[model samples]
Target: MAQVLEFRLPDLGEGLTEAEIVRWLVEVGDVVAVDQPVVEVETAKAMVDVPCPYAGVVTARFGEEGSELPVGSPLITVAVGAPASDPDSDAGTEGSGNVLVGYGTTEAPARRRRVRREQQVPVPVNGRSAAPEVVEGPVPVISPLVRRLARENGLDLRELTGSGPDGLILRADVEYALRAAASPGRPAPALTPETTVASPATASPTPAGTRVPLKGVRGAVADKLSRSRSEIPDATCWVDADATELMRARAAMNGAGGPKISLLALLARICTAALARFPELNSTVDTAAREIVRLDAVHLGFAAQTERGLVVPVVKDAHARDAESLSAEFARLTEAARTGTLTPAELTGGTFTLNNYGVFGVDGSTPIINHPEAAMLGVGRIIPKPWVHEGELAVRQVVQLSLTFDHRVCDGGTAGGFLRYVADCVEQPAVLLRTL
Candidate 1:
């Protein structure tokens, strides 16, 4: 007799509480090896492929793609020690002890509770079998999503047979029923606004627009920005500076360089120096403690827009790194962001942010501060503009710089001083040499 083992979704750390199933790698009765990835899930941070700890025959799976499941919820069940036709390749009596986000489980229950397929039934809630009740004496059903879908469609679960293991009612069955109801000339049951279901038949005609759900990375960005707007009393100030010298300095450095230095890296170097002179900007407000806790290290965060969305990847201990190292680190993090492989650590713990919206062709923007950070510096496009140089009007490469800061941290004088220092540095890159 094979013992059944239930595998729950492991806690993907950085305070992530839930994950939505993105894809399933295995099907029922499929042979799975220990530590093999069984499903791909999207959390707030990134997409992660979750590995199964048990090596066995996959007996059942819970949740459909795009459905969210909380941490510690059963993802799949497996029959350990099940006989495999190719035992040499498929069967294993051992288990994988691999850990994910500090979670690993290989223990099987002492006494196996054999749940026969025939005994599985839909649990009743408030006299409805589709209410996700987990008791005996009801129809055999699993996921709450299936029940919710059926209930919204007014489809009686007692009538439809399930295609999943042990007559389990899957989301597909409800979808199939809903589609059948919405067939031409077939009337859809009237649904309430709160209980409405999406379908082809009774569904209202969609206009020429796409509706993308704000989930995953996009959702996280929305939540963070909203919080920053609601809680932080942020103010922005801007100045235009002659970046001709800065641009020329970069050219000369690259001309003399073995390793190319990025313009953003140079700006980051300037930011670190400014923050060092005015450490008040590198702090977070602790609302609960009624304190403004100053941070020690400069974990510099810079904005990088990817296909996924706008993400700010942090360069750890950036204040301690040279311009060359900063350029390399930024490249690595930006590539990771584009590839969607950035870990939660790489995305968090920023003391300040540099928003180079210039890349977007925008001259200037009042960018929202990344939450928990005290300030964000915004850089605009460097374009040739008429400016005064040595008391004469001339065309110079000018860039708009804006700083958005939390008023609770410092006054306008400090902010103004910081901006002036940055502008001076850009106007003359040699000014940074004194700080260096």
Candidate 2:
């Protein structure tokens, strides 16, 4: 008796309804192991490879490449066990979260997975899959950003090799090409300047031009920002603090071999301590329950801005972690955001959020609140300025802090006091030691 398995598209988070099939790793009639890479789907957040949840011969592909399939749709069918007319064989409610990428529930498959794929191979250094037959070509190797910059600067892309990681071209490469062209070094290559210009001498007229689909991370970011701004009633407050002591503490703790400690880690510690002193700042306004729910555990949300958009990946039980542990977890979560490898579990259940805009020289700006979470803190860049200490002028390092909270639940007094407490902790980080 052979068992048949049906693979359905699962929820890809942010409540996505559909996704485009970028590529299929396996084809019909291929004998695949359980949890083998079956297909790659482009969601609003990233391009993800979903594994086969059960082992069997590939029987059918319900969709084709580049097709957009709605979440909860049947993607493939494999005979893994005795075939049955009833579809209830896999309909176990306990495993609904196991749906394939871009597929959601309500269209869930009613079967328990006998096995699921576990290992995944990342995209190769060449920015393409490791499949055979791709030969070396003179294609310009520039980063996606550098490619955009080159086009904006009217530089030919074919003339430069990327100098960045994995042969990714940099903006400097394009600048070099421009400088070389302006001088007597070499004649510039013939290229089309106007994007829409057509020549009468071509062998074939360019077919109706293709438009790059705005489907993945880019599209999702636009939608989320739009929703967050329109729905959330946000109020922001900014405070300035002397961070001289914080900076000195960081300098003294720089060890040659241990995990790198950063000011953000210390700030996170301060924020968690402040949350304990004032639990109201750490509560979430649960709309469904029509009440504000204060979480017992301190799961700090680290807001990361990637090329895809803004994401807040949570560090579970942040209150329980020391400086070193928080630093390690922060590094891991940051890498996860950049590589788009964060699981749905790490992306959810944030009690309080923090965004470090100071790294980009932003002194202060109103940050949008992550939905359901009542507030978020923004850390600004530190600068040296003169300050009056005991009525004497002295140079001091000062940093700015901003807090944005939902006005529906928190009053101005409560929010202001919370920001004051955070500022106090940052100015004198020793204030956090007592809470610990």
Best by lDDT: 1
Candidate 2 lDDT over residue span 20-57, tens digit each: 77556666755554555568776665557776666555
Q: Residue 323 CA error for candidate 2 (Å)?
A: 1.2
Off by over 4 Å in 1: 90-93, 96-98, 101-210
lDDT of 2: 0.70
Q: After superposition, how far is residue 394 of candidate 2 from its true place, in Å?
A: 2.5
Poorly placed runs, candidate 2 (over 4 Å) = 1-5, 12-14, 45-47, 62-67, 79-214, 255-257
lDDT score, candidate 1, position 268: 96
Error of 2 at 365 (Å): 0.5
TM-score of each: 0.74, 0.70
Error of 2 at 75 (Å): 2.2
- Residue 55 lDDT, candidate 2, scale 0-100: 57
